[model samples]
Target: MQDRMTPAERLAAVLMGQKPDRVPVNPFILGFAAKIVNLPIGDLYADPRKSFRAQLLCAEMYGYDATPMYAYASFGAWEFGGEVGMPYEPGQSAPYIIRHPVESPEDVDKLEVPDPRKAGSIPIAMEIAKLCYENKMPVVFQAGEVLTTAANIAEPARLLRWMIRAPDVVHKLNKKVAEFFIAVAEYFTSTFGADKCMAFTGGPVESNKLINPRQFGEFVFPYMKQIHSKVLGMGVHVILEHPCSDQNANLPYYVQLRKELGWNGKYIWAFGPETPLEKQIECFGEHDIIMGNVDPPSFQFKSFEDVLALCKDNIERGIKNPSGYILGVGCELPPLAPPINVYALMKAAREYGRYQ
Candidate 1:
């Protein structure tokens, strides 16, 4: 225990597949923090000040090495000058999206990517990033893939349908969306310092579970690569990448995408809850850091023992990876997850994730 690294050093060292005192306990806590802090979900997402405090509280409470950004994925909608409808949920923070801005190919032609520094939530997101950097808390400043952002403003179904029926329109829209994220990534890396800044540049739209390789190749992959390359070019080594929920089947394609683009950047790919752990270790062991797929929703019902086992199970397999691994929730932990589960998880990591 005396020889173990601090949380910051642990994450950095393990990411390079170097020795860490123990496996880093960096779960993706978002709404979970809001819920525990008693802040209304929508309010926290609206104000970066509250968001920053909530994240600080989470790091203090769970001893997490980092905070996952974006409890609501509507920043792109806000930046694009699209309307967002906020609806209340029965037990949790409001997850909101108003309407699709790009209802037709004609709309794509009108889409304008704004400057990140002045864009809607982009400035607010930067404030939060700066706070995290200043406090020495690692965090993802720009999150959600270009596809998720584009889909939020353009509508998901519409984006997918146009992929087949109106491919040209999709390309136009993706290029603009990708360009916007590149600017945001550049700003974050340059302002906060690349080592402290990270962003999730991959998600559902390109996953094999949701879209076939051919479809992704045609509609999403190129823009994702462009954004990925530009983000790395800014000297941000640890880029956060992922597939949508339960889309681990697309893992191989992600590796291929990185190779094809000659991405020489360090990366962190969060494994989905349903993504096979064994397979994740087998495939990602060579080059990147793999975070776990701990399903956050289950923590609502699962006993402390259940959460403990889940953490231990993942740690056992994750620590076997030759590259690097970190314990992470499958997605954002919901408001109802038992607070005890947080302790249960960290306990498992501390005890089992030790580098014997």
Candidate 2:
């Protein structure tokens, strides 16, 4: 079955709640893109121009159906006056926080919200957004999830301990992070016009594997609701929420947050493989688009056939979703993943993800 629509058309159709000729493939590729273009992975995070160019090249080569965008998991550290080390080595995929800003409770009180346009990676991200706008693609921006960004600033261990020992301090830090993300939402939407921007963020630190449901409810849910609600209220139509790992236990809270925000049919939830695809659909299939659950490491360590098999299974299941589905990796496409294995996603979309 030949594709009846271009990649953009296919995605547009899905966004509008209509079926296209086939499922769109948007594997959560990032550092892997730099590798494909023979650039060091560090360039993907440290240099916005290089990152966007590599991503565009890789997407064209793979014939995938997603626009190039920039973000790293360790988002808050550098933006809030901490330091980060870029991915300079072969195995390193993203910049890591080298120095956390809030080393003590006093630091949290002293923390100030930096200008979104000039702070840490926001400048880099703005450059990418400009390129995307120039190229007539959606201008995407990262709006940090409250807990994850706060954890980055305070250091995860200290943040978690603070949740128990100094609950007030934790809330204060989260409040500040929320302020930063709200400011980011305001800046991006104002710069690009909310109608033209897509806001995205993930919750790796708030994953159920590390924190239980009660903790997520207490620490993660309220702030996330505030940030996303503000983003949507600002006229940003779509938000991509990637709950990065084992968040099955946290699904109810997410569903509740989505409801309170009234983001029905205007959100995309991309789950990590640790959260079953069935569960994702069960939670959000009535309205939002469901993407992912493909194991990222399989693209690096498994055979092409095995990778395709995984894609096939996900597509078969996800295609049944009422809202829509996209073929994608649960997390960042590993930098070392074989090109053939990455291509397997597109192949699976073509072979088994057809609508007619």
Candidate 1 stretches greater than 4 Å from native: 1-4, 68-71, 85-94, 261-263
**How close to the true structure is residue 115 of candidate 1, measured as C-alpha lDDT?**
81
Give per-residue CA lDDT, model 2, range 1-356, as digits (tens): 46778888988899999998889999999988988999998998889889999999998998898898988999999999999999997678889989998999999999998988888999989999999999988888898778899999999999999999999999999998999999988998888899889989896898987899999999988888888888888988888889988888898998898778765438888889988888888888889999867998899999999999999999999998899999988988888888999889988999999996
Question: What's the TM-score of every candidate structure?
Answer: 0.92, 0.98
In order, candidate lDDTs are: 0.73, 0.89
> What stretches of model 2 exceed 4 Å from their correct place?
none
**How many steric clashes does model 2 contain?**
0
Worst 10 residues of 1 by lDDT: 86-95
The lDDT of model 1 is: 0.73
Compose the digit string of candidate 1's lDDT tens values, residues 1-68: 23356677888788667968878877777777777888776656767888889877877777767754
Clashing pairs in 1: 85-98
Q: Considering only N, C-alpha and C atoms within 3 Å, which residue pairs clash in candidate 2?
A: none
